[model samples]
Target chain A: MVPLSWYLVVAFMLVGLGAYGMIVKKNLIRILIGAEIMGNGVNLALVAFAVYGGAFSFTAQGLIILVISVAAAHTALALVLMLMYNRRYGTVDLSIVQKEEVA
Target chain B: MNWKVKMMQDLQPVLDLFEQFEFFLIAALVLALAYLALEHKDIVYAVFFFGFMASAVAGFFLLLDAPYIAGMQIAVYTGGISALIIFGVLLLPRAQDSSLETFATGRVRTMGLILSGVIMAISGGLALIFPWPETIPEGVPEQSQSLQGLAEWLWQDHGVYIQIIALIILTTLVGAVALLKMEKAEAMSSITGEFGVEAKPSPEPEAETEVVDTEETSEEAAN
Candidate 1:
């Protein structure tokens, strides 16, 4: 039988990687990807517990994770779209924004 | 060895092989995809790689007996988020820019990597050393009909929280529309003012084309 600890270890490693990515990456989209990784790690832990702990059903955990994932997707979509719009205006660099000269 | 002994020995080798192969293979693929997503310079490619990583992790989830979460992982992350990210990448003017110089490095990256390594080491050690409780407590239900149970719980226990979250999402959508629409109006006014002429109400496609043309001209001038 596959032990639950293995899943926990994998989830921990993912979360660590995500934290590193968030800390190191400068790009907004990359940071969002990191955030997604972190979210995945949490989902993994949740499911692992549900499977092994016997306190909760797999379905309940699944539904919660599904809702959270959808919410995350919606938020990331909006943010990434906004970032692209900003990039189109010749500035993705967060430090400087050259205001359009309104004639 | 006797016949039974031989059979047991053969089965042991097969089980060991699968144990070694499946676990490490899935873990390596997930980690590699994650690294690629983090390191890729192109936002579009990064998003695509991230989607792969999510799908791989979802596979792992399924293997761990959480099939529902696995399905949602693919549906929400791969289907919805990845598509949105690609759309965002398409909207950017310099979508093809592959400059590694845009990435940050130096002390921060080094520290981040070191910290992550330490965390991983500690967590892995703990996972390996600690003994998990194997036996379930008496009276706890082992199997459940999930969907019906979840529906009952959602309505009875968490209905109000769900309603609040839904309301918040609705407000956010409204706010996003209002903000984007305002920006569009401002940009239109500015473009008209810059041309110093009564701007014809250009069709949406023509307006988009004009914006792209302006971006190309700007890029050319910069070069």
Candidate 2:
């Protein structure tokens, strides 16, 4: 098997990219995309650990499916929220939060 | 397609070179697509690249010998989430996204770069420092491979989690519907020209000017 650490490296790199996107991107949907990327990184790590720990396809189905399901639900809610924000304010630009200085 | 057996052949390095090569290849694809998704100026195209990145992750899952999970990832992420986002975009008024400036200036990007680098360093260090066992522990229950095994494990061992997730999905569905209805109600009120609605409003100076006008007319009558 490939050493677990190498898989970890890839996972963390993806997460880092996601973090960068979330922090620097001005659009709400882009931030949500960043969150999805981060979730993917986490799922990658979970599967890698499961495989390396010899659970192979087993944990992949059980835990990873649960994770994916949750992510799917979350995506649906987030899209709705984005739609609401867009309809209300006429834009999804997150920079308005900074101008408003909302806590 | 089933080159997993080939992964057993060991190389000179501490890692399995052939397996590493395939995993890294998929990983690279995932990363590149993720980057493109984040950097793309158009939100729709960004969602497009995100779907591709998710497929690339499914390939990574396949490399790890989890074809079932890989299939689910493809189904949920590419088919479901991406479609949801695209439909959400389509629901918007025309040219709504035209105002969106996706990327920040260099200073913000640089700050994000530094912070992300720090996150990488810390997580990587933790991964390296932790005492990872060489093999699966005897204490942990054996979860067999394949869908049948997964069904049993999910229903028998972890059924509560499934129910909880189902509840969450149900709640999200209801909440999303409610929010959409609320938006419609607000739109109706705005269209009917309801006063004190948050939709239509001018600057505070307009309100102050009205108060000043009333006070000046009262003073003129007094004079």
Per-candidate TM equals 0.71, 0.77
Error of 2 at B32 (Å): 0.5
Instruction: Give the distance in Å from residue B128's predicted Cα in candidate 1 to where it truly belongs.
Output: 3.0
Q: Residue by residue across A9-97, what tens digits does model 2's lDDT show?
A: 88998899999989998888789889999999999999888877744645456777888998999899898888778666666777776
Q: Judge candidate 2 against the unseen true structure and give its global Cα lDDT, from 0 to 1.
A: 0.80
The superposed Cα distance between candidate 2 and the true structure at residue A77, in angstroms, equals 0.8
Among residues 3 or more apart in sequence or in different chains, the pairs in candidate 2 whose N, CA or C atoms overlap within 3 Å are none
lDDT of each: 0.70, 0.80
Give the runs in model 1 whose Cα sits over 4 Å from its true position.
A58-63, A66-70, A77-81, A84-89, A94-103, B1-21, B134-141, B144-165, B183-185, B188-223
Across residues B1-223, which tens digit of lDDT does each residue of candidate 2 receive? 3465454344335345656788768877888899999887777888899999999999988877777888999999999998987787666533235554645889998999999999999998878777676445534434454677777878888799789888988998898888777655666642343122333344576787788889999999999
Give DockQ: model 1. Answer: 0.37
TM-score of chain A of each: 0.69, 0.90
i-RMS values of the candidates, in order?
Answer: 3.6, 3.1
